[model samples]
Target chain A: MSTRTELHYAFALAALCALDVAAADAPVAPAHPLDAPAALKAAFAERIGHPVNVLSFGFGEHYAQALVQNAAAPDEFDEYEAVPGRPLEPGRPKKAGEVDCRKKIAFAALDLDAGARALAQARAAAAANGYKTPDNVTLGADVFCNDFGWRAILTSDANDDAMLQIVWAPDGTSPKAQELHDGGWRKVDVAKLLAGSAKVAPAAPKAEPKTVAGDGRKRDFRRGIDADLARLEAEVGAPLGFKHIGIDRTQLSVDVFQSANRKRVSTWLVGDDGAIKLWREDDTIPFDCNKPFAAGDFPLAQLPDLVADAPSRIPPMPQAQVKDVAVYRSGLCGRPHVYIKLEDERGYGNVEYDERGRLVSAQIQ
Target chain B: MAKTAVAKILLALGASLMLAGAVAGAEAPGTDYGWPNLTDFLKQLIAKVGAPVKVYKLAMDRDGKVDLWIQDQAHPDLVDSWEYDHGAIEGPIPVKFDHYPSIAALDHHVIELTTIDFPRLPAMLATARTKLGQPDARVVFIELERGDSSGFISVTDTPIWTIALDSPRHDGRVEFDLQGRVLDVDKD
Candidate 1:
């Protein structure tokens, strides 16, 4: 190619490069801050009759995480402020006092006295609307603000919303307290803001066993023996007879101790099958006399059937009135258990079970 | 050839520098609102209960509210429990008593009673044991109160039952047998 042609090409390329450089250096317009305080104040005035001054503002992330890390840390009020001349540089650190008056916005504030009032109003509003707050309230010192400055956040009884935050900081200019003023304050849907602040209800108390009225005068001495015998027959799938010598009803639990102490035979008639049937020692099934009773030879499933057919009379098992199922746990085997106490005119019994299947033992009260 | 390689390396280096500059320019610092501080609440509860209490469980409900279960050395069965949101007590504070089941199907036997008034610890304990057929079991009482946001007064301790007072008040007590039976329940 000719030198003149090469020169023309180079000039065109140089012009293109210059244009790209200029475009790269051009500045873009900055975005508007959220201006949370102004928006909130306006919202509060509009929603509530009175204009509110935000005593403080809590950035949820900062407050929640900080509390988890150091439940004792002082309240923080430092926030990001857009520097007037240097938009491209890191913003300046504005203290809570400075931010209260800063022009470049998107910040939120918590009202001290006004905040408390607003919270009271909000809680009343919530209660009327069927929303329940937690029962416990916790507050800390206003470290960020001095005596003239109030520093506190009102969480629901459950500490959910941090619903109301109050910061009474020194007027920066005055020593005496001024009539509580509403800075750029905003009204928040406390329930909405505290959506995650529901107190966990305590696990429902266990139900007491129900006592049934029976013949209080004459006691059935054979009831315990009968329970034991029926339990044995059901396990063995046959009848096992034994002479009932005596019964001990004086103790809290009525037990019929049999004469099997002398009999070393593995075929000994275990009087009340209920004990063996419900016994879960190392997942071993009790001996079934119906199937030719043997030590640890019966299937676990048969125990329920045996206990069901037992002639012994037992009181109804107590049922638990569980208001919250989320924390329910069965007392047996440390598993989640739910007991429905069945009661009729005749008597009552406890039907115990869990999310899985039937447990090894169902005691008849 | 050496000159050409050097020129090529310089071009690659220039391109990488431009890319790095562009990436750095796009990054921005984000703001974060920290978590709340609950030390004051715990401390208040310790002071109010007038006993040494340990937090056994801390749970948040579906709505993000927090519930604390604290056990006092005096009353292990009776847990001083409370729930709170931001800085306010959401509801009434009450004492909880534990109960156990008598039947074998129930496991880890425990029953709870809640009352507004403080009751005699011994009476509550005795009633629970007798109902559950566990007379010789140990009993515990838990007391709780709602304080200003500064802190909470959740007192838990074994009642000495050394002093006898004549008054009708609400209180809660829990009874658990050695075998984990929750036999009786009495609550105001």
Candidate 2:
């Protein structure tokens, strides 16, 4: 077996052994399923038939109730659950096997300042389990579960009736109930049935390597930047446009504009006092700035007036009360100007007013 | 996404301009202000925000007006206003927080940034790392503010120290008060 596969298998075996010990040590209980997360992940993967990413989950609740509904085909259906953590729900103590399927749950992040601590905890748990979660997030939680980003949910206090009903909106208040037509669910295989179909378990990958800031060394910042730029040019075989640089006793880093239009870019860094070799990756920007600077649509004195109501507000989202528009004090498309963008639930676009506050141009996508 | 100290300082410098405007009785909006005087105020503002990071106020030379916030200062590593403006400056509008798009150089290459209290950075970072119980974590960036640019600043002259830390587990940003107590921690 390859090193990576062997490493993963060894981990799986060790986890299974740990679960066995925990279960055996308890006089009259099943194992304290430390491997429960892995099992659940494998099971979801089997059902999805794709390399399903077990994104994130809630905690605190002792169990998860998986419900299969709207089976388009015998195999094609939807899964939903309700997850609650501590303090949010008066959860009953687990009775060993009682912590099986038929309950949807998650842990609680009781951060004192977590405006949506429970949701944060759930997302964190998912992150820990190797799924994707957004950095900018919001949750509208009431006494029970509110409509999250799902078609349905599972749980007793869940505002939706499908984890019984789905509000299809963040506003899950007074949702139309999905009556348990065929006795909803009583037989959920949960983690046990997927034992055979489960494959390699995936855990959260470690963060990419990066350099730490410096420890107060005395050196020529400009020389270091120049050297690095020369090195980059040598490696890439092109003249790199210098965009930005920061040098101090702690570290030296630089960004380069890689395109003639000036939208393409890359970054280079020398960390650990140049102990680590620098790395580079190129990228591009969308607002094309190939054209020469011209007199824009507005004058300098009325610059603020242009942004006060420029048509750049895109993708406006009133659902989570996320303001859709934002003004920028930066340039775009290789031009120096104040740029703005508008956004909502639909789409977004960009607008650039020249440094003097004249209308340069705008593009929406 | 935090406001730069220089921007705040330039705004504070406006206080003096306001007083001068009042004294000269030239505060009226319609008064057509011309060069030398018009040009001097812009120069002072450029100084207020510090140099090499010029605020491109566009072409308001035709009008007696000004609007600038150090927009074109080449911010190292971070595309200036990347997080704050939601990527409207570089790529498409409303870029994702999770999306740290690879950047290549374009119009700017190196930006000269003026700092205050930079000498104390090492000690402050050490304090923050120890307090955070992240001994292995590294300080990726820092922002140290002592006083505003309008000159003497406040009566107490409180300094703000914000430190950014990157570790294998997660990224953390913290602010320290004058007494070195942690003000807040941002989990990324």
Candidate 3:
């Protein structure tokens, strides 16, 4: 063969090799940590200072399969079935023998020393509440806005005894209060009750005369005179008008204010055509006809520009992001659903879309 | 003419045979030279080095990238090991396997150590030394066979302090100094 022919063959071989190398270097999805090297186990143990086991709890069955691939002896790792439990529903009572009670939500157990330190901290918190633990007293009931914190419910057979339950904020701020439920646990608006109790007493009322002596004929004549006056006013097309009836302006104003307060704030405008229109505001309060009309409801044209710009006047589209992406299969549902978690600063905001990609009711998870 | 052509061929063949012999002689242990498995090798090394230098547990470092350990006679229970890849360490240092064959000859345990950054070994060793004190150290290099008909080699060097490996095969020829603490390893 000529030198040129040899060079051509060589160039073709080189091109093929380059393509092969590029194909080999292309990035595939990364394997889960279990399929990782035995070295990873050692690193985890060192970091956590305990025997660390990475387990899959929820709907991801593929994770277990991935882990088997990297096992040193092929299936040497221990596998345990997660206990079946009901999905958490807001305001529902926790059932007896629920698997969720046994589920280990914490990443890892604290070492002995760390556990001791935590216990000491808890003791210090308990002492600061002006009540000792294992004490007996009837806790005064009150309601306060717990809005975003954990409140514990402590119960004991001793009817008058009370324990301090610590309410903790996510940012580590915690306050302890004595438990107060007597028969059944009830949630009360403590702030409102305390405000009502702080009001001062009112003054006494005056007595009125029981009777007056009058001739029956004079009474009948006076009544006839009143009826004649009313007839004369009706003929003239005008009724008698009061001059100084000692009107209570304060009470009248208060009645108007109360009626306005009962009214539901205007939310988004639903067109007469029955289509829900998108608004530009952050929040929308739905309009209810049962509520008394308030200042919130002026004609859209009469509203101030700022108020009109707000979400109640014009509802804004929900803002969301993909917080976590998990793939799950439902035999009955038939199709795989990609659960794209969207969350703001709130713990777990509403999941807006359903399996069919349509807007559905928001569920707080 | 036939005799001359034959002689020319003979001379060429002779030169080639001699070159092959020279290359074989220069081959590193665990390559051309044979070494046993890592577990057996470690046992033999500990026996040769003598007691008080104990080998306890072993672990791969973060992400299986490196192997590191600490060995102290005072605390036989505690051992530290760190492993790193070529990217994690500075510079390219070829794994030397001469010291490994002798260590392996003592026992039959084999551990595959892939090519790693030499500088990372020292950094990890420094940390272990601070925790476990200085000890004699030795590195065992092994060649791993891949499924693709290609082979990649790695080394696992143990910093063993005060312990000495005495054997007729080694003849005290292999040794390394870690910050003035010298570990005399058997190269043979």
Candidate 4:
């Protein structure tokens, strides 16, 4: 390897702290060590000896499925269902003699390339020490985000008691305190765990609060409102008509007046810190009275006609077809318009319908 | 990544280690690499990983063996490991695992074992919202994972779901169960 690559690898390797603990540094054992729920964490930290990204730290069976496109073939996506052997879906009935109890599972995401190397290293090490690698894991990046390098997860039971029949932790227990524990709910004890325990998992990364120190914060907001408005005005110009302003302890909202009277207008939440949260001038509040309707409100049968009838040139499309239509009532504009997500400047446009099947307000987005 | 860590490293490697008066328990470890304990070594390691956050729990088991995982700030699982055995904190090489247990691997039980699927995501979210009065928190991401329920002790593979959300009112991630029950609320 080149000196540069060797130095980089050395630096990366040094980044790793420590693995197995030595006998000399062992802390004085508790006079009486009990197998409490906390034992799971202690053992995991002991085995891994690294700061594992605990995904979740509670109990309940959970899973999901999403489509991830093959990088080689961008158009081809594969849908993988990470399901339980016999999962209990929503609204499904529990069966007799069912062993479905709340168990903790911690998982991590690995950088595809790094993961491959790590896996190879692990396999070599495991083989040297009598362990085998599993088969058929390509280690592809997830759909949500691929920039992440790697992730590690583990699970442990919160139950301190060691009764096999006890599916859930005791009601008043500090560790596995569930809302309500009923029959068929089981909690595992750490003593019974094999190498990979089957009881508890770590929690996800904690999210950032809106206010760092109560100075009014939000997600994706811009630096300030005046600057944002100026930028929007520069882009949309005369059409940038916002006429209403509302303020709360945390947020300062502003919107456009549908009618000159300003009675009916859609609301936009500019960050209380005076930042613009979104580039759009509209409110994305799922179901606002201002935006009474959405893409889902319309009938399925009308989708084809709506797509075909949507004016192609009114929005002034350079070239491209409408891939999807999101219909919503623009309370600020005082009209029901369809937001079109296009395939290219002609790519996307919002078309407001006029009487007699004519296009009233069609603008490129 | 953290200035304090770099200072600690540089100070440890300098001539005449003289931090006995600066901070209580600042006496460096008797070992060659320095640092009084595993915790200090971890502080430096955390900085190297581009995360300067507090490093909690550099624990050793009863067998005189300590182990742990340190991913970058992002949750990608590029994992590396080092073992300090019987107070051999200063020497011996470390092990860098190319792969540890991902969600899928944990479910499959090659590297480790756990319940197949821990907590169903959407269902718990619906419950958490109702219990929380359905606050207008912008949900950045909702992840269903199986983690150790009680981390004070051993690691048990249990089911749990974390809903990372933010709102003008407040911001934090709420962890819940499949029945839509709130387990804990971690304010970020």
Best by TM-score: 2
| Candidate 1 i-RMS | 17.7
Per-model clash counts, in order, read 118, 54, 40, 116
Q: Compose the digit string of candidate 3's lDDT tens values, residues A1-365.
A: 99999999999999999877754543222233223323222233332332322221211112211101112222122222211121111112111212111211122321222222223333444343333332211111224322323333333333224433433332223433333445344343323222332111122343442222222222211011223223323332433221101111111000111212333221222222222221212221343122222222222122122111222211221333324322222233233232333333222333322234433334333
After superposing candidate 3 on the true structure, give the runs of residues whose Cα lies further than 4 Å from its correct spot. Answer: A1-155, A158-330, A333-365, B1-112, B117-122, B125-188
Measured as a fraction from 0 to 1, the native contacts recovered by model 1 come to 0.00
Between candidates 2 and 3, the DockQ winner: 2
Which 10-residue window of candidate 3 chain A scores lowest in summed lDDT? A245-254
lDDT tens digits by residue: candidate 4, A1-365? 99999999887766653222232233222221121223322432343333333221222122222223223433222232222222212122111112122121222321223333333333333233222332212222223433122221221233322112111111211212111134343444422332223333323455443222223445222122344445434433334444433323345454654333334554444454544432223333434443333212333234344456555744334454555444334455454443444444213455544212345566544
Tens-place lDDT digits, model 2, residues A39-103: 43333333334221111232222433232312232222233232322111212222222222222
Which candidate comes out best when scored by lDDT?
2
What does candidate 1's lDDT look like per residue over A8-40, in tens digits?
Answer: 999999999987775454331123212232333
lDDT of 4 by residue, B69-162 (tens): 3322353322334445533433222223222234333222212101112123333444445454434444555544445422222253544556
The complex in candidate 2 yields a DockQ of 0.02
> Residue B43 lDDT in model 3?
28
Provide the lowest-lDDT 10-residue window in model 2 chain A.
Answer: A86-95
